[model samples]
Target: MTYKYILPIDTKNVSLEMIGGKGKSLARMASSRMSVPSGFYLTTSAYKDFVQKNNLQKDILNLAKPEIIGRTVSFESASKHIQELINGVELSDEIVNEIKQAYGALNGQNPAVAVRSSANAEDLPDLSFAGQQDTYLNVRGEEALITAIRDCWASLWTPRAISYRHQMGIKQEVVAMAVVVQIMVPSDVSGILFTANPVTGERSEIIVNSSFGLGEAVVGGQVTPDSYVVDRKTFTVKESIIGPKAQKIISSDKQGTILQDVSEHERSQSSLSDKSLKELTSIALNIEQTFEGVPQDIEWAISHGKLWMLQSRPITNLPPQPIEVSWEPTPPAKILARRQIVENIPDPVCPLFEELYLTKGLETPAKGQSRKSFFVGGGPMFVTV
Candidate 1:
């Protein structure tokens, strides 16, 4: 089948050329048993079409060039012109029809969808370009969806995004954006999950940060959330910390999102029980296994007591773990001293050094010193061999 911009669920084997990283990953996840929300992808081809039809290739090329020193007038006018050009373009009929059809297929008429950006370079292993683009929440009907798609495309050129791209050595003109239209889940609770403990990099442990209502308050650092640490192997709840929640963001009946104060009774309560925590941790482990690497950041939501994974990306800021080294037998007193020394060394020292240091006092020389024939510098000398 000859597909244009958007693709349905049946297009499983499409490469990054058909969709972008985010879209392809979502499709792969959906095709599997993972509980991803229903959606379709507005392919990068459509974005390319918009740029080409609007004669933006040369304009983008010009904007991407590094400015000369002391060139004040050049930078300002060029940036302004690019922004104006982007704002002036309108969505074409072909793109609009595909989006409407996809929305209808997922949610029928008058449905609310979450329009999110899935750029070509996001969710990568070496570097994650997260939050560089925009996401529209609780958008209803065709008109709002279309506007949101345009907004997402425009967000690819936000000042912060432009700066990040420049810093990452990614040319703005070479990057393209694909839109992910997902069914909006009206979550009672939402938060982030790390398959490994971010602070410690413990692979056997999983950490969850949750709060009442949508995940925005927690993600935005607007409120402190209740945290739960689970042992991946035993499925045991290791620890839980309940934080004071002042506010929550939720979907509004009017439209978009709204923030409201959480009630006193709900503020200190745990979002998930022991069983639920274990189940969620298992799901996270499954995703990690499926993705074949440890995930750094995971966004999830709980609706009607069932957990759903919204998104996941590698945690780029975490440092590597210290390797373990085995030690031979050592005397008890010496082992105690080694423990004391380890306590003093606050930094993460090499494990091999730690093992050697711990066993240093165990080695003992021969009891009696006897005169033995030994070679010293290729000549015979009287010494212990």
Candidate 2:
């Protein structure tokens, strides 16, 4: 069957295989009438076509094999060689024309856009693969956009990406890169919003991290952003901590991006207003619902007082749901404290271990053994095991 190499952002039937994880999510969001920026997906078919036409697949896979086996071929060497091979190839004229046509459809002449990598193996429920590739922001004109797209493709072979895929047991040959090209939002305020508290794992809390200028400062860990924790049920701000605004990233006139310092007056102020926070929270909740109630890590921006959804993915490594377990000590144990051995055992003991050790071994003595002089039981306040 033949598939088009390009698809409009709102194409509802786009699958993870066709457009990769981020592209599929963006398409879904756009179709659902979320405030997503206008964009198009350069589908994985395009990437495969490029690779096949250039005959780089075999060489690339051969280079990747060393990382999985115990071969001496260093990750840096393999990544560098593979990326250079991809970057040196020329994209087909058909692909170039399609990209140009799509770019022209956006508003204005040479509109700046963000070109992001969307890999088939990324943004999964169990494997996040976050920040494993490249995202070129504020790319303008056909040449720059095309370069950014090629760079995004090459980023699939970055050292970290190669090592991560190997560690996760993901076959390198099965992975393909799709690109998300969206009109840049000249964000005066940008940040990330989590539907659930990533740190505390509280499903009832929404965490917002905001900063001035583009979101790169916050997303790239260039600055400590203003943090606000909002109660999900009541939609009220629980805690707001203002960060030192410091420096921010913005687009350069010639091309690419540059950093600038925030004025002293604005440095001490919150990046988002109260009303904006409420609106962001509501939108985040709706997005969570749209994804079948899976907690989301959403990237958002405010341009000219309007909010835009940049990206959303299932929050990875989220802590288990909070429960209402009482802290009172159980039988024989008067108080629970972290002694030497307890300190060594950091995490809570699994149920199986507790049952075998604390219940059977300590409390009920095995077979012919007599009743223990002291019984051991678990308490929520301490790690007894």
Candidate 3:
């Protein structure tokens, strides 16, 4: 019998279809000499095999049928059922033994890891499933790693994920998941770097968001991180905004991950230094170049005062950026209309706000234009028509 493959992070033989987008990207980065944390990829074949052995496809697909409520499709029941089924299933002996051996080779006993879900359907040009699935951090030991991997597989059936796939008209039976298990970085600071300015659509600038401890604090909205904008050309720190960080997420031997209150003195400090910011920018720029200058969203962690690239994906659905540094306003004959929101709205509108605020209440049917996430940002709160 042909068995599934357990590939290392530096493997160059696998494609995105095999390991899923996140794993493929990380593997590519590692192969290209990028400083990624040592880890391995559990290919989608594992997930497929588990589903096949447990005979879960029919049950999962049945649970994915969308029900029309008062005005829209809802799959709350389907999502819960599918997730329970996924989590309850057991893996085959072949895959389980391979995973155990790989885990042992990672770093002996109880190596801390971050198990992240990498769905085959994610990171598409039109869709950005950035954080729809689960990520278990600071996972130590073989049992914890296995549990985390199972959780990631189950996250493929999460409520938000189900709804997203449903709206996108993707069949549940076709969706498969891979898990990326990386050696955990005990980071002094961890955060994300956008090669292009995600907010202002400035391709010439890069944005960095950093906070204390694990990046979950920054990514989970648990803390407002210090934001830094860097000039792409000169690699200069163009702007910096300090955020009030009230707490931090750190790892403890006793508890895998524990939240500790930030001290009064540390709350006001910037998480990243100018030097580290420059280093991060250079790395991000390199990644963007590797992807043919299409902007990238990268995750990084700083440990032992050195920066490591965790993952990199294309920046999806950015507005057209300015071609020239200096340009003129609209010509007199035609009235100009900017298709963007001019306010300090956050990047990637929250799901609740998108469904409730942006979609339900604020739409103006009279204008004959549905609100399509109007180029969101802040500037005078004025519509230039």
Candidate 4:
């Protein structure tokens, strides 16, 4: 049988169109021999298959329209409705069989895995869609895995996601979600690494956030992670702070990972050893080089002291490097929208409307208040300031 639904993550042969951005990046790193975990990606074909099988495309598309046409619900209501629609649909036997077969290849029976969302519209160099979709870590068994995949698909139509796409001018019909399933790393220490300093845009320094148990505590902002600043060239630690990790999430046999209180003794000590910190930084630098020297925002974990790359993508919305002198910062101004709006507008704005409407100087209903409208372009999409 042809396996159009599922494809291996590490292969260099598949296209981004199939596996989506997150899957393609993982494939790229795996190709470069980076320490990426073994995984499989359920391709966009799978999402299309599910949608087509249930005749869901039309209903979802109409609901997703920014104009709020059918049933006329608020964003929250629309999100709930769309998610309910997806969750209620039955999966095809072929799709279910392929998913089970893929999981069986990973482990003999049921094994813990990470089911993550991979969307075609995310992971762009300029836009950050990292956490907009759902991710289920430490998921166990076939039934749970199936449920996670369905949830990941439902996340594609979430209110935030729908708003993001509409505002960015991405067509709802053109987008699809690919679910990524990977062996769950039994992490002793897990964290995030930024190749370039996120605060000052200094390429010479790498920022690392480390914590106990799973990295989700750090990534999800559930707890304050131990922070570190390491020099890029020398691989020397410059700064460190041990966060108050009073609790952590650890894997459980019956219910995936569970959050429990930490011992008073373990709270004061550093979550990462000096050696581990240096090593994670080194691997992060290597990842930066692997991505053609672009600054990278990487997710990482260490299982049995072996480092693994969970995900990596270009650092979106990074400021210009301090050394670069191509342009200077603009002073505070009353511009309506910035580059995101410019790039998002697919069509040209009308010349006539640009001068007359949205040019400012409007009155308000209140005695002291004046109404001002700021537009994304010369379009009807306006923001009240």
Candidate 5:
């Protein structure tokens, strides 16, 4: 492939350093015959080159200053200048040719692609920079792709992104932006999937939130979606919550996106069948197994009755549980001790004394103990031999 970065299917077995967790997973999924959109990553190397060429270190240091004092910097001016600098910079002919070839391999000429940001710091176990950067959908032509790449790079410094970086304790200088350019799926239904129940932290269940048209409505929380909770082990739908979906976001005829209301009949119906839900759970479990992780937050799209995994990330907000230890070999009888005491105090109290004796029997003694005599109620009582 003569592309700056190869397609996910072509670049299998990439390490975390080559591409972050998210990119590596996408590439692996594509290679596994899973439904992943045709795409190419810009690679971390390209991000490094942009940083070195633009002297981004100085700019980042300046941006960090205001962050130290809990003050926000107006990114409008800085962002504008940095974007202009990046857009003005020309790509090497070799890199340009490589990108052209890669694009050509994906059905060539004027294919509409979605350019999204995938940074190394994003989609990690400790942090999830979800929706922090920008994504440009329906970008057409090679020239537009180049511009979109630059825009994606510039989006790393958007006001919300800058603020998020500060909040996350991420050093602006240490971060690099990788661009993911994928052929856009003409989605009829799209939304997010949680491999585990997000609300209750239950690992045996998978939760899905879906909406008609584009996924923006569900993602943006503009409309209530049809929610499904399926048992991961049995692949059975445990619960379903149908919402009154008044509107949906769909692709515009000209370009970009638009919102349209759902028909009265369609709004009442379930978007996915029980069989499809089971199939989706299987796909999600496969992804989870491939990553060898507890849970994953997945983005999915359905087009022409086929499901596609758009993105996958570790569920970062989930708290870690204590590790369970298994019992193997039984301990020696001497390791356990039993103690008994008798006192003719009261009939009702005798049961309490026996219970206390049994309770003390479970305790193990310290290494050193001295024999001592004690007097109880003017009566001699043996402490121990």
Candidate 6:
């Protein structure tokens, strides 16, 4: 059944404008038969309609104007006002009923789920407004889901999010929020996977951070997760650093999440086995391939030994592939030292500059001077070995 505000997780023909970045990516992955959890998207159209009905555009724009005009206005104050305007307004009954129906279809009666913000401007190759908006985990029941949805919309006006958008030059009126409602995976082990090594910018390496329980412990920095660097080609673990794994985050019986302390024995142990690491690496490689070889920042979970993809986005601000450098000088210049002329040159010299200046211009003495005279007359002689 088609709904005005909701689309199934595996819906085809979804665009970033309609479902926002997160929703679109999830839909793509789901349609591709990836092991993504069942979910639905509260489309950006829903957010727009809510705002229009509540007459919030003018007020939201006006509040955000100070930031645009370069005034010394408090972002916190403006964000608070805008968020209040959004949260205080009642969502239409039509939209609420649609959400209830979708939620029911997703996992039967009041299933525990995650409500994530998916702004239209988020998770792009250039602009990754990651963690800029809210994500409510372990949200249950129709009323709670509705409240979470509204709060997700409000999170768009968070102080950090507002400042980030202002910095990114994203217009206030142009952006809209979509919410991803996914069944909560009671992950035994969960963490993040970088299809590329984000630290050293090695495209051939995949990095994984694994921790016990829900991924929030790893993602939120509540605990230092076990780190594994795997060879992308071989799907082998190149390095592993076991973290303390002191604590883990889990969903509460009622609602929200809980941070619990791990037992002494468990704290010292590795969160993931070698087999699981290989499996994760394989999945990461597949995801990278799916996104046309673009390095991905993926969120994943393992429940009962099965892998589930929560989210995957382009790894923004990733450095270029590391260039292999030979310290030994080429040809006649066997000795390479940061001395004399080389002292001022911080970066590697280009071949053109080297040919035009170092090889020719520097080698030639002044018009009236001989080689010996050039050296003796205060002209420093460059020695190329």
Flag clash pairs in model 5. 2-98, 3-98
lDDT per prediction?
Answer: 0.74, 0.88, 0.82, 0.83, 0.72, 0.86
User: What would you estimate as the lDDT of candidate 6?
Assistant: 0.86
State the lDDT of candidate 1 residue by residue for 1-385, as single tens digits: 3447777743577776566667767776667677887777898889889999988888876775445558532344445566677778897888888887777777667777888888887777776667767888999988998989888877777666666667788867778889888888888888998888888777777889989888877887888999988888898888889988878999999569998999999987887777777777888888787777766578888888877778777777765664676543322212212233334544444546535552232233357753222212211111222
Put the candidates in lDDT order, highest first.
2, 6, 4, 3, 1, 5
lDDT: the better of candidates 4 and 5: 4
How does residue 292 of candidate 5 score in lDDT? Answer: 85
TM, every model: 0.81, 0.84, 0.82, 0.81, 0.76, 0.86
Candidate 5 lDDT over 4-32, as tens digits, reads 44445447767655565567768877877
Which model scores highest in TM-score?
A: 6
Candidate 4 per-residue lDDT, tens place, 264-342, comes to 8888889889898888888887888888999999999988989899999998878768875342222323443344444
lDDT of 2: 0.88
Q: Candidate 3's residue-wise lDDT over 1-385, tens digit each?
A: 2335588889897877788988888887898899999988899999998998899998888778888889878877887888899887777778888888887888757788888999999977678898899988888887778888888998898878998987888877788999999888999999999998887798888999999898888888999889998999999888899999898899888437899898889889888888899888998898888777778988898998989998888888787886664333323313334434534542445555656665454455557675532321222222234
lDDT of 4: 0.83
Estimate, for each residue in 317-362, the C-alpha lDDT of model 6 and write its tens digit: 9999999964444344443334466455445666666655655655
Model 4 weakest lDDT span, ten residues long = 325-334
**Clashing residue pairs for model 1:** 296-315
- Candidate 3 residues lying further than 4 Å off, grouped into runs, are 1-3, 323-385
RMSD of each: 7.7, 6.7, 12.2, 13.0, 10.4, 5.4
Residue 8's lDDT in candidate 5: 54
